[model samples]
Target: MAMAFQSILPTLPCFLPASNLPDGIDAPAVARGFATLGAWSLDDFTSDAMWRDSVALTGTLRTFYSAATVSAGWTERCFARQVHAFQLNPDAARVVRPAPGLGWINIPFTFATNTPTTTCSGFVSLVRGEGGWKIWLLRTILEQFDGYPNVDEPPQQPPVPIDGAEYECVIVGCGQSGLSVAGRLQALGVSYVVVDKVSQVGESWLQRYESMKLHTPRETSHLPFGRTFTDEYPEFLSRQDLARGYQAWAEKYSINILFSTELVSGSWNGDRRRWTLHLRQNGEVRSIACTHVVMAVGAGGHEPVRPHYLGEDIFQGDILHTAQYNNPHQWRGKRAIIIGCANSAHDVAEDMVEAGLASVTMVQRSRTCVIPVEYMPTRAADTITTADRNQYSAPLALNWQLSRLHIRAQIEANPARFDALERAGFRVDRSGDVFAHVHERYGGHYLDVGNCANIVKGLIQIKSTSPNHPIRFTPSGLLFSEGSNDSHLPADVIVFATGFKQNVRDTVRQLFGEDVYDAVDDYWGIDNEGEIRGAFKPSYHGNIWFLSGTSGHSRYFSRFIALLIKAGVEGVEVPVYRGVPGKAHEVEEVGGRGRGRGHKN
Candidate 1:
């Protein structure tokens, strides 16, 4: 059915008039507009008149109402740069028509002077309407540093800190979330440092199992303003490959990262409006002070939420969390039962089967939403590809709606894949709401790469457990229920793939005190206005902020987080705009713009 539908796509009527085309557009006007873009200085962004004339007002009229807020975010990243000289080579410009009236243009440009020379080998997007050709979107990134491409390097050693030091901001992790916001701060010339307990930038990934690879494609996994991978790199990167990339990004950009350091505690100073942080560096205590603090520790804190069962002390052969599992080779020929059927559990089961385990069984406690790896952004059908989806322009609610429709169609066209899983007693949520699964629960789903095939082949067994009749530990295995008919599954080893605690606010409370924990909102969920809860925006505490998510999210929203911190440091008033309840079309400003934070690279 999908093939037949594709065959007739070219013959479908678009119903667009001839006027809504580039052929009817004024070529000279388009050229003149780009020339103006090349001539403008950094100061032009601050002028309201220039912004009004150059930018299309597509927020309330055409696309999502949040378009205005995104525009403001762009300004925060592009504003107040100390540029000695700027160059835009229009002769090298390339324009391609995406839709009837929309044009995507890429012009290689350079910013030289205030810092090391930087360049962006990309283009700006424009739309033609009654208002004429105007700048629809401008994506500027730090593509090349010092006229050379960013390259990967071995981990760089961190500098020892003074007994007491001062900085404008202090980020509390060195993973994707930490590096992302730190890179943005570096671009904005903010004084900051990234502190992590690990000794290296990508140590987090390196410590995971050897077979672990990214679910998302390489194009979507890049950090903000970081370099793209060459043909030598695979579409999906392994743990080692990603760790090398992170090390190189940090070294090339001169990101100040202090290794072997852990954040002990933080106390907010009300009168001074700064945070006094206590840190431990390789067993030595050090102190630092900063006006802004970012808990980039991640949406999942370091503390693992371990499950307890009765009689564990007697029955345990070997039990561990997924975080501690390395390779299945150690458990070769041993019976293994993995609890929780999330991504980690499925991946581990597949590994165990390949390693020739005596038996592999996954205990499912609840329903799981599953989708094939190909349905990801880079490999999806053309109608739902990354080119067709503009996360910045479209609202989250609209995106979710479109995603649901596309996913349902894809599954409908290939029913046998899921049908087989259901036949094997594996409960699958066919109506997979990927966004909700990610933002709300963070788990209860797995992107099928090779696990479903193993499950269907009977190499990996399934044991469905009910929450009402909880399972308990037996001497040799697990007891499904208390009744006489309850089944007992024997296992030589047990691996709990159960997920971590969902709320990072609790982690914040543990370090920053009880008042901060109560004052901050819940992290990592969709709020009323469709914005990510407690991220990239000011918390109720005023000076505290949080940043975490996937690489794509980190690349995009890091700028917003930095912008808020930059504004607060500079004493600028930020007015937050929110939609009116029950009035879908109505939007009003409600103190969103805070004084600190900067933009993405």
Candidate 2:
């Protein structure tokens, strides 16, 4: 059975002892071997390589340097240093004990150069082979602007008293969105605090279904200004690896995060030009103030939907949402019916069958665009989605214009991907590549990662959500409609993979009231500027901003949001780049909460 990672990789002072590691292997020595490569000249490293087969860049490394750059190893800017120091993180080294003789260990490292004063954060994967521990993967992302933080220090020191410390920004939801924003804010030297409803870092990843994985490649999902590689590349990231990385990232920057906390309510005090937030931790509530609020909650996975059903309360069998499902093995030998068809639905269905369930059926409420993971080049998505830290550091209009072109290419490539989905029964209108279809529509498609194969192999059954074949719960099981046909499927479990309601207004109303909620535009859509509707721009409410998107977007755009907040605070003019072609930029006044026409829940 898959278990929650109670103890992470062993650390010098903290991580519990790692299981399955060969005894007496020096970890710091192994770390130095990889650093040698990262500091080497690009030509010598790639021209006559030693042990290239074992090397692969993690998502974090790939985003900064492509495979070619990784092959080159080090950039021209980096060379042999005068005072060399490498710190081996004991608790942060993740062990991959697939087998006794065939296991690999992943270690995260940070090194500093003396002459030029450069610092880098990276991970090295080492395998225990005949020649002792050898380097398998060496990938690092250099921090050019700010030095890596004193990782020994804790960021928030959980349950630590806030004591009415006024912050410049208060970020809610410490998942990818929150952490990514914090990284950017930290790099920009913003006075802020990040708080999550969960007790621990990356509990969002841990609480997912046992088989849940990143549908996207690993390279694009890194936290801003930090290393985000997994133990292996191309392969889906494990919850354990992700959890450990997040913990390490939190430590590296000491990004201020208060876990086991909740922002019960927040209201913008117009008179004081700040937001008063009710923060609840350990059953005690305290009020804190901040000039800006970033709802860093992800675009999805919030406010999950348990679809209304007749007699749902009286259903004898177990009823659950995909968000709450973690153990499919526990439901072994039971008949299960999962409603809604998407990534979660397919993952849950396949997991049930693999866990030795008696039967499983999936009901498709609407067509989903299905794309193969292998369709794009390995890490191709990152090239388009990732904002070049240097490039984006330029003027905002130029950065977005480049972004617009990159996204257009993805949209143009949609026909082929959509054609494949149309051949699989997705409606013509619902077909597009990830950008034009999946991320833009919230989700109208599933990134096939061996999902369609299960349906083809008859391991999982499928049904429709058409009104003609409406699903009705009987005393024993479910009666599903199949066009003009009706069939009874005995189910001991009913799992709803129904997606979340993207109602930012409803969520905002609870804290700031209906007036503030109404001040924002529709939570999501392509605006007149061709940029995303709610992100990186002012929502209808001036002081009120919505910061929710993929991690790559957060890494790239959060800097702009920080600049906006900074401009607003320092009484400087913020050039409003409306993202429209041939239009001159306009300077907007940077104070007061401006209202907009937005939707109500």
Candidate 3:
């Protein structure tokens, strides 16, 4: 009868350790039986049978004896002893199947070993052995084991589309001001689109001469939302770094940009209450409709102005403008002459000199201001705390006051601090000094002393004409007047650093028809012939606004304009300025609030 039971025992359902079972079984009664005994322990005799049944079952073994020790040979002896006891009895009878009335029946079993009688606590199942019930299977349930439930993860949401339908605003430039306006609009949760004629953001700077870098430090050059690279690189960012930083910022914020899209025309549709944009993109014409349009096309996007000089066409040697000066390698080892003494002219001259050019002559029609990248007090090594550094470096009126104090102290100690050429063997033509010359030209109305200082220090040479004779062009390589008897000086190259002209009114007129100028004039309350805020006044309609070309020239001024635009959009009180013609302009103390004016250039 026992032999009949043994043959059928292997077919009976036995509850082994829960760990031994396949996953996803929800049988609670079988699970409870596995939890009661330590069937998962390595000492359990039935563990070997369970491993034999499920070949996937594996356990980690630790050998305590070192390789050099004599006991290392006996390590396997201990393992063999355990294996022999398990093989002799196998403890296969302890595995059990639960009855309906009894919770769990523990049928004790003994290991069939000749060495000694070793008993282990386990459970046994009963099988119909031909005529009567007989012990069939045995297993020790692992009492302390627990099973974790599985959870299904939720699905992911799809991405939001770029250049989506129904844009609230459309800004037409990717330069500093355009970026600022786009960022502000984004912060307000307003849908907006930015379009640029160039293929990449900040290409305007990339197209400039190799020597060009930001005049302002990164702390002041940062756009809206406090996005800047100054925190990472304390030094001034080169042109390429600046361009890449702008591109990274646009990507980080996911700013919608339509590259290589030229704005052909845009008109205010009063009936639809939206502006219709006619643009040319990749040889295809597309029109977009938006409630507001911001024209931030900036001052330098159009073709450069090449003045019709008398001998310009006749000169056989290379003659390029500052805008076209890409690299100095072509002019290396040659006598390069750069015309005009503005920032570009100075920069080009320095670059040519550094690139192994034989001689770099700067032909100056007038002097230029060359201020240091940062004033001494604003430098990182100036020994100021981090909090005070930002405050002192800010573009606020109070910050300017601190800067002026520092400048005054330096200038008073040595007036020559403002004149570098005079110290470098070049005579200063001080008919009235640089400050007097500036006061005579623009009057006190718009003169910035720092700009005046830069102009004086950058003047390397002053052209002088002899009495009764036309100014001579010297053969010794110097620029002289047309009437001079001296021979024309030969130059390898000539570059013009004449400043940029801010002329967005013509562009606006061409796009929106003649009505835009009149509308803008009336909106700013400008008299028919009068200029507002040093240029054509800005006009704001609802949350939409336009900052004309004059405002785009200076970086400091553009930042102030951005702030005004933000305040206007947020329904905050507009800042007002009040001052007479000659004195420094002061903001009115109305409600103890005033808007900062753009920097005087």
Candidate 4:
């Protein structure tokens, strides 16, 4: 199916001076109009049959009204969480064109039942018709998190700290992925503890090379509930800055994190549907029990990949992988040869050259999709890819689809970025956009800041050859493949920027047992149900879960993971939601079908 979509921009009269709304849509007026309809929905929860009604709701309101009862427990306290979540600007309204004829804005609201502490969140779209606007579509988004159970401080039942800890949930890996999940779990009042192998929270970023800076912009990469960071960092932040921010986020939220902890083994309790994890802290073995266990360790750190060469023993010099690469301060006059052509390789080669290396060469083993940092605008998608779709308020799946369509267009529009590099024997791939390429093959791409410029300017040597080319070691340096023009390149240091073991299943197996590993070995790929296999969704294994991806993704989808875990803890029946209920339509154009990208680099 074509995954194309259009981002709607609304227009209202300019005479309205009371509010200055972006795209000229009277957001406050639209909000007030939906509030009136929200009250009316309580009683007149009726609409004409299906899509032919005076106001259409895409069947969400009909399905909600058909329910046997809507309220539960003590007094029904309702809360309105603005549906403009898709837009960063609070004053702007999220507009969408579900059908060619209908333009609706999502007005998300939630209601809570205090007794059992359950919440239901959804949205109502105010349709812009011939007579101003009227409430059209109403739907349920999520049951637990979006249900608005608390206001001042979120609803949370503090974890019970104890020796040989037993808890409802144990979140492993204290990186951003784990911290994001911990925040969501804490907000839901779920009893969960976060554990990591490092000594501090932001060690992951701090451990990277000193010169590393995020390729992504500051606003899009911001953590959930931390808008302050976006302002503090208007551009890409340094690794040290990111580390301090991570430590501060954990501190500000009172996140429960256990550092210097290693999981020796995890055994599944078939009868109880829980996990008994054996952990080692300070060289002492201890056991912790929990109903659910979330693995937050990503493919990047699970295992470093070191491809073998023919005669590595002949070379007597330092050859380090990018994983252990700290800085180039020592390799001042050394002849360094960086293997692999991905981002790390380019970055490392650039670092060597800038560090005043005698010579730096980057071997391009495969084709890669390289895009500049401008691909991600401060705002959302620029041109609408499909008329049937909307970017502001679509289901995440559909949004992913639309995003790919939009990004593909951006690449197609600009050919100058890759043309010269390709002419210079560089294999630039247009098989898909950078986003899809990353998900499909983690190997192909670098979001260039300076490396490409150096490659073009003859500052960095480029060798376009197969990754498995024969490499033999010589006493002085190394010999390249016989087929290549340059048979030898003297090098004192070789850094492998090759990828790591991305199999989440294998990584999980190493932490748990084979049985646990077997349960989720087929980790990444499209599943039978059409959902992305393994990460946020439940794996083949029960209770065991995965949390991996960029920080923004972790921030957004952590709620779903927390809700599922929360369901198990509270013993509440989770209602079936067919992909975040909304009016965003699927792309009708077949040509628009493509892959997508994540928020983080």
Candidate 5:
């Protein structure tokens, strides 16, 4: 395996600790093999027979060895071209056996060209077969970025932007989605600029509610190319921590960004195979052209959903969307009603109750899939000896299966949690796949921190609402139908935490024209293959891409996204493989490891 990798990557020497070698393997013979391979490059072994004897391709492992669209070992070839040098730390090498014949090997490596070296770890799973131990899965996690900056220190000089420069790619938004793509682009040596309507790097996160903190642990939230939140940061990152982290990341990478810049309009030039964009930055209109445009704006778009009630006009209270909400201190003595029951609504309700509000009520419209905060993800990188990180490399179907089993186990072990919420008049949805509720539906769930207990203890009131009878606003508050009886809930403020309901298509139409909008596919939601639709992968309109979701999604998928864009930029012909259902052989065409391309775009 080391010789195979060294064939293409001269700078990266894959080291296997002599103590950790398989039972039958001879260390001296391995040393001899490496000594003889000094004269040969990857090109010398061109035939299929060279790799056929040693390598067995299967399942998700194909992603590491080859891609359906590109040639065999395309990923490694690209990585070799991008990275300068790699130094392996043999001390960190270890292997674990979950069962007989199954072994997982982890090795830590570093990039040596930066002021502070970048650390990364690679995982490889092997199965002892009739022939010998063959690699089943190979994965890597970039644990830290090269030359990570210290945000606590006095601000350093920002990178100077080139006047009227043309970029190969123009990324919109500077949040996780945008920065993740930018990090990959920087690694690939792609000329790009990130544009945000906000004034600073972390303004998007900073503008969120002051009381907000991520429910998921800090381990699962690192940006792409391996930049992590420091040890001093909270386990669950606060809004301020995330904000400062984003700012520091941009500085660490010297990412070129234009603040207070809005894209006025955009049009694709099919003739020239590029995009022409009109951007307004600080009152000046600038026109630029690019080979690609990335809409990393986010899933919850700029438009906030504010549902209007019958008598909202006459109501003598503030009707605001959660987007306008800040700390709950202002509403300390007032009665408050929050209109949704997902993560944001739960958070707002908890805040109001904690702030000593006279009345804090959550108006739930639909059944929500609620889980204990303890069940949420912690970083897999935290454990090196365990096979925990392999879960990150699982395919969509496999992940769905694992999630279903895990949720089932959780429900069986803690039935009281769900029962308590149900008895309290909260609709706890126990059916359907949790992954679908998150990745497909986008928001039908909430990871309970303290809100579940608040609901159970009646500190936070739950009023169920339905579309059958619309809510009506009164001079004092809202009128709802409670099991065939009408109930009046008095409130001074109604916060619509109904989420960003605006369709992505509308946002696309508003930015680009109808033609471009029509050309693009519907964004978000999982497709037939269980992979996210119209994102990371190629879109209907070849040069346009959509990136959404949390930091983990961005970190994992950014590699493939960058690879696709890089192929286009370098004029490498990579075909698109659409899989056929129920036919394993036909589907394998989509997962083929062949060495040639038919057409691109």
Candidate 6:
């Protein structure tokens, strides 16, 4: 039946009229105007119903009435009026002629309409053999409301440059590690320059929250060259105190630090045995050549990450991550929800609770092992003799031997104490395969000995809600999967204390490009039979060395990194681990492959 109807249709003509559009009006303008008005181009108007629909949709008179008044069937009336107005053009009538082997013939024409308030127009005509006609292509001009204006002044030219600049070493990043490296190099009589992207030393620490304080004690966290918080504050230092210490250290040592300078790229000039650093400073790009380059850009330098979730876009209240958490003052009287149960989450929760927030709820994803800071032994209070200092300075062999002896003595003196504490509900776990149930019951006084007692006590309510059960998700946040059950808890704000990725690889790739990875892979030197170093791979060229790439070991990071820098400068093989003298054998056996241990070259 469809084939029979097709045989009865009229045929098209051979020739059709060409377009009358002006030269300045380009193809885009014609298309845009046709698209804006209620008209279809010749290409699109072949289908009668589709052409009618286009005309109805873009008509100006229809738009005016629809915008000015609301009436039933207004859309149908607008479409009808647009079709009638389209039929008024003589050019539109002639172009509807039919052509051979086609459904319609083509006739091109240009016309202008003032009702739409547009400037240009063009159209294609189609002619049918039996006398039916309609437009196939229709277009109108789009005027430019804003024209080009006169320019003011010409651009300036760059000045010529001089040569013959020399530097012994150029260190990038002015954080704790960078300053330590520079100080050690200076003591060794090596000339060096320290540069940081920020405007001041320790500005990175200043960016942290107001309640932020060092997790480790000041005595263990001090830099080399004898500059320490103990010289001033005998306890843990606050964020402000840490910043001041960094500033004073830089001033006291007269460490040459080029502030607000960033190293964009660097290359090893094999011919000159030096590194050529392309640097960006004060909107100007410059180059510096140095014999040695030490990168001390610390961990946690990148931006914080927040995962996408349902209805996140529709969230009506305040939402912020730990990176933006300056203080708890704004949240003092507001309800807050802390997401994730890592160290940062716990610390932030404590801060908010202490600041007198109306209500604070911790949404923990997983159970975490918490170790009290005081559990770790403190440095002896009395001044050490020269012999004791020397003993501390000896190689890993003697250091580890003595440390093992000390650890053994402590263990012997407290043989039944840990067992007794476990029986009394202390909930402590060791670092090996033995998983012993330490505590049968948990009570408020269980955390009395720890400084974070309030935070630990808050866990009691959450723990009582579900004995040995994991919370999967609440009306507010989700919990980590443990054995089988799924659950959720309700809260206000969610904070993820879930730590950062080891970003040295990313930083290296961004600064040096991917080619460096090829060299790193070839020189990694990890024994296949033994465990790999994970992320750290040291590279050296003669006496010059690069010591930036390392993995995600958080505990003892600053100290280990300082020791590595010290070893690089002294031209010695970097030790597998840093420990007390005369205990290397025991330390090597237990510490080398332990959690957080990195393989050495």
Name the candidate that leads on lDDT. Answer: 1
Alpha-carbon lDDT, every model:
0.63, 0.57, 0.42, 0.57, 0.61, 0.42
Q: Cα lDDT of model 5 overall?
A: 0.61
TM-score per prediction, in order, is 0.72, 0.65, 0.54, 0.72, 0.72, 0.52
* Comparison by TM-score, 3 against 4, better one: 4
lDDT for each residue of candidate 5 in 250-367, tens digit (9 for 90 to 100): 7887888879999988887777877889999879998998888888887647678666778988889888888898878887899999888889998899889889999888887777
Comparing 1 with 2 on lDDT, the higher-scoring candidate is 1
Off by over 4 Å in 4: 1-140, 143-164, 228-230, 379-401, 408-413, 466-468, 482-486, 528-530, 575-601
Off by over 4 Å in 3: 1-166, 299-303, 374-405, 417-420, 423-479, 482-487, 521-544, 547-601
Residues 476-517, model 2: lDDT tens digits: 677766667788777889898877876565677777887777
Clashing pairs in 2: 10-90, 10-91, 11-90, 11-91, 59-219, 369-445, 469-481, 542-594
| Better structure of 3 and 5 per TM-score | 5
Candidate number with the higher TM-score (1 or 2):
1
Error of 6 at 576 (Å): 14
**lDDT score, candidate 6:** 0.42
lDDT of 6 by residue, 390-508 (tens): 22222222222233334434444654644543343434332210101011000011111232455444531132122333333344443434447544444455565544443344565
Q: What is the per-residue lDDT of model 1 for residues 464-541, given as tens digits with 9 covering 90 to 100?
A: 774334467888998877456778889989998887777788788788887667667788766544545776566656
RMSD of 2: 15.4
The alpha-carbon lDDT assigned to residue 50 of candidate 2 equals: 20
Q: How many residue pairs clash (N, CA or C atoms closer than 3 angstroms) in each of the candidate models, in the order given?
A: 22, 8, 19, 6, 0, 46
Locate the minimum summed-lDDT window of 10 residues in model 5: 1-10
Off by over 4 Å in 5: 1-163, 382-392, 431-433, 466-469, 482-484, 579-601
